[model samples]
Target: MSPRILILGGGYVGMYTALRLQRKLRRGEARVTVIDADSYMTYQPFLPEAAAGNLEPRHVVVPLRRVLNRCTLLSGWATAIDVAGRTVDFSPHRGESRKIEYDVLIVAPGSVSRTLPIPGLAECGIGFKTVEEAIHLRNHVLAQLELAASTTDQAVRREALTFVFVGAGFAGVEALAELEDMAHDALRYYPELKADELRWYLIEATDRILPEVGPEMGRWTLEQLRARGIDVRLGTKLESAKDGRIVLDDGTEFDAATLVWTAGVKPHPIVRHSDLPIDAKGRVKATSRLTVEGVDGVFAAGDCAAVPDLTNPGEYTAPNAQHAVRQTKVLADNVLAHLRGGKMGDYRHAYAGSVASLGLHKGVAQIYGRRLRGPLAWFVHRTYHLSRVPTVNRKVRVLIDWTLALFFRREIVALGALSEPRREFELATRDK
Candidate 1:
């Protein structure tokens, strides 16, 4: 019988690793299967654009089943991993639990939003991680304009016009910038709402933002955001937002309709459930070879694994797409070598650089020790991400989206009705 390989999570690591393995391994050498909660892999960097309606949500995500043709695609969650028993207990979308035995296991269940125990945050804050959040945010933002236009209450309008975003990392900054741009453009359609009436606040606990782009670029980004009328507050913490009333640690308080939390992410909860050796940060401890320490035949990578960075000693690889995507090749090779008794390779890559988008025509990038800002950086951001999105179909779709966008005005129409498709039916049924 051929060896059965089970891969958890369908993020960059899981998808790319499976893609590579299917080509490298001969038929009958191994059977591969991937199980994920969602059937698509989100190119997370585009969540901001998706939220802003700059790109269709469908184009940013790669459908896993269509791409992983040779591998079994299971749309489910891996509830448990039996390390000693050599089996994985999985729960399907609709069915009884089942156990699958595998000769090799790959754990790459990506991270989830790392949240703090702040009051009201649970109810008021939305994350910019998945495509669903992006869609919901877009709908909500447009809905707010509708609410403000139709209302005469100053308090209600004030609340709807105020936007607050916590955590100024790449996700937070880009999302805020893009969404802000959308809102700014959207205001042109709302005669009652003036651009000056909208208020945006970006609250960060640290002294700087976008640390991945280095100090100079980070500072420049802050200045740019401030210049765009975003209230950039450094060394500030969100006190609370219970009942949609914003309160800050610096003794400031206000009402806001939108609060986005993009602080960071923690390892997927499944890692803690497994009996793997974890580090202080709750990440699976992995060697430079990408093997989970002390777990035979089990490998971990991506945002969940604490893989040692050979080039940068004394530190694990940063949880970024650049490292995560690069690590997958080495990880797939190592897994294949382990199965075939071949030599394994270590995962090592120096920090190349970083890129961030500030709205549509503005950006910052630091590549190979060169710093670039403004329109060139923005163009590079688009060009690089377009190339990185998986599948020729999706790349073409995204490029078409951009091409069409260039020839036409921005599509600012809000289809909030999409979120609650059944509401009208329910109301009709009740009336009858």
Candidate 2:
């Protein structure tokens, strides 16, 4: 019988692994099955653009059913994995649960937003991780603008136009910058509104922003944001957010209609279901070869696996797309070696530089020990990520979207009505 390879999560790790295996593995050599909460995988790098309405949301995602033709796609969650019993229990949204025995398992469920227990955070804050969240943010922002424009109350208008983003990481910065640019461009439509009336604040607990680009670049990013009139509060944390009112640790308080949280991420909670060896951070422990340490016929990588960094020695690889994409090749190769009774290969690569977009036609990048900024870095950022946006079909679609963007104005038309379209229908037929 052929080996059964079971993979969890359809994020970058799971999707890339399945992509490689389907091409390399021969017919019936191994039966590959992937189970994920969602049937499609989102290319998260374009999420900010999607939120700003610079790119269509659908173009930024890859549909698994259309791409993974050779593998069994299960749309559900992995409730538990009895590693010793060699069976994985799967639960669907609207169906009975079942256990599927597997020869090998790959736990790559990825990460979730690392949030704090600060008051009102759960009720007020929205994360900038997935496509749904991105679109919702866009709608919410536009709704705030509409509210501010239509209202006569100065206090209410001020609160509606105020935007606060906690955590100065890549997601927070990019999303804030992109949306700010969009909102600034949108002010012309509102005759009563002035661009200066919209307030943008980037609050970070640490002293610097864009930690991936190093301190100097982080300072440069700070200067750029400040030049654009953003109120950047460094070394400040969110103390409370009770009732959608934000209170900062440094004795600042305000009511903001939108609160975006993009601080960090913790490994997927699904790892606890299995007896997989985990570290203190709740990440599955794995060796440099992408093999789950001390676990036979099982492997892990990407955000969920704490794969040791051979280049850095003492530390594990950072949870980034660069590492995850490169690790997939090594994982796929090692899996082939395991099937053929050969030794597995080690996964090692030095950290490549990082690039960040600071609004349209503005960016900062550190590449090969060299720093780049402005339009050149922004073009490079778009080009590099566009090259890595999955299949050629998606590549073409995204490229087309970009090309059209140059000739057309951004669509600030928010479809808030889409959320509750049934409201109108229900009211219309209530008497009947």
Candidate 3:
């Protein structure tokens, strides 16, 4: 009988691993099944562009059903993993929970936003992790602009137009920059609004932003943002956000309708369900070969696995797409070797630096010790991610979107009603 291979999460690791196995596995060599809550895998790097109206939201996500045709696709969440029993508890989108047993398990559920217990944060703050959040943010920002334009109350207008982003990582910096540019361009439509009236703030707890690009490039990026009139508060932290009232640890307080949190991430909470060996940081322990440490016939990678860094030694690979995407190649190969009684290879790739987009035609990058900025870096950023976006279908669609953007103006239409499509219908049905 062929062994059953069950994969959790359809993000970078799970999807790519299943895709590789589908192509290499002999007929009926193994039964591969992928489980994820969402039916599509979001290309997260393009999320900023999607939010800023540079790319359509649909083009940024790859439909799992269309790509993984040979693998069994289950739309659900893994409630628990009984490692010893070799079974996982799963709850589908519209069904009761059940147990799924597999001969080999691949845990790659990925990570979730790392949030804090700051007051009012849960009620007022938004995250930038998924495509849904990206679109919602775009609409919300534009809606805020509309509100400010119509309001005569100065306090209300100030609060509505103020935007605060905490944590200066790639997500925070890129999202803020893109949306700021879009909003600035949109001011021409609102005769009552001025560009300087829209306030943007980037607050980071640490002393630096984009630490991946090294200290030198980080400083340059900081200066560039400041030159564009963005108030960057480094070495600071968010104290409270109760009711849109932002309180910083450095004795600053303000009200903002939009507060974006991109601080960091933690491994998916599902890891606790299994008895797998984990690191101090709650990530599944993994060796250089991508297999779960001390576990037989099981593997893990991506943001959830703490795979030791061989090149740097004494450190684990940083949880990012560059590493996650590359790790899948070695992971798929090693999985097949383990299943077919062949030799397993180790996963090793030196840090390739990082690239970031600071709105259209502006970017910063450090690759192979070579630093670039401005249009050249921006072009390189788009080119590199386009090459890695997976599937020619998505690549072509995204490229077409970029081409059209050059000849067209950005769409600032706020579809806030999409969030509550049935509200108007329900109201109409009620007696007046």
Ranking of all predicted structures according to TM-score, beginning with the best and ending with the worst = 3, 1, 2
* lDDT (tens digit, per residue) of candidate 1 on 1-432: 999999999999999999999989898899999999999999998888899888999999999888899999988999888888878889999999899899999999989999999999999999988999999999999899899998999999999999999999999999999989999988888999888888999999999999999999999999999988999889999988999999999999999999999999999998888788999999999999999999899999999999999997998999999989999999999999999898999999999899999998999999999999999999999999998988899999999998988988678877888889999999999996
Q: How accurate is candidate 2 locally (lDDT)?
A: 0.91
* lDDT-based ranking: 3, 1, 2
Model 2 clashing residue pairs (backbone):
none
Of candidates 2 and 1, the better by TM-score: 1
Residue 345 displacement (Å), model 1:
0.4
lDDT of 3 by residue, 19-104 (tens): 99999999989999999999999999999999999999999999999999999999999989988999999999996999999999
Cα lDDT of model 2 by residue, 262-373, tens digit:
9899988788888889999999999998998888989999999999999887999999999998999999888888887888999999987998888889999998888989
Q: Number of the top candidate by lDDT?
A: 3
Q: Estimate each model's TM-score.
A: 0.99, 0.98, 0.99
Judging by lDDT, tell me the better candidate of 2 and 3.
3
Winner on TM-score between 2 and 3 is: 3
Question: Candidate 1, overall lDDT?
Answer: 0.92
Instruction: Flag the better candidate by lDDT, 1 or 3.
Output: 3
